[model samples]
Target: MGYCRSKDLDFAFKVFEEMALKGFKRNEVAYTPLIHGLCVARRVDEAMELFAKMKNDDNCYPTVRTYTVLIN
Candidate 1:
């Protein structure tokens, strides 16, 4: 999470992958940090991928805050 806040997407994704493999339950709190990091790093495509993954895989619907970050 700190990694994500620091805009370290590579590390963030690595951690995220490991967590998923270990059955860490994802919620909006988890997704938001990564999404915000990706956006801050200007990796919009990767952010969108995360967004899609959140919806499709994790069943975590996005919030207005998420959309707002992605949009602006």
Candidate 2:
């Protein structure tokens, strides 16, 4: 969350990769903050990639709030 909030994509990606290796699953709540951070930073490409990953992942599903955050 701090990584995303600070628009630290490098750290965010590192943390995400670590989580994956550790078998820690992230859901919509996890995604929302990242999306919000990317949007805030105007890193739309990164945000979209994350969103796409969420959609492609069987474990992580987007919620209405996720869409709302992106839209707003």
Highest TM-score scorer = 1
Worst 10 residues of 2 by lDDT: 4-13
Query: Which digits, one per residue and each the tens of the lDDT, describe model 2 over residues 1-72?
Result: 788767696788788778779988877877788888888888888889889989988777889888988898
Clashing pairs in 1: none
**RMSD vs true structure, all candidates:** 1.4, 1.5
- Candidate 2: the clashing residue pairs are none
TM-score of predicted structure 2: 0.82
Residue 28 lDDT, candidate 2, scale 0-100: 82
User: Residue by residue across 1-72, what tens digits does model 1's lDDT show?
Assistant: 899877678898898889889998787778888988988888889889988888886567888987887888
lDDT values of the candidates? 0.84, 0.82
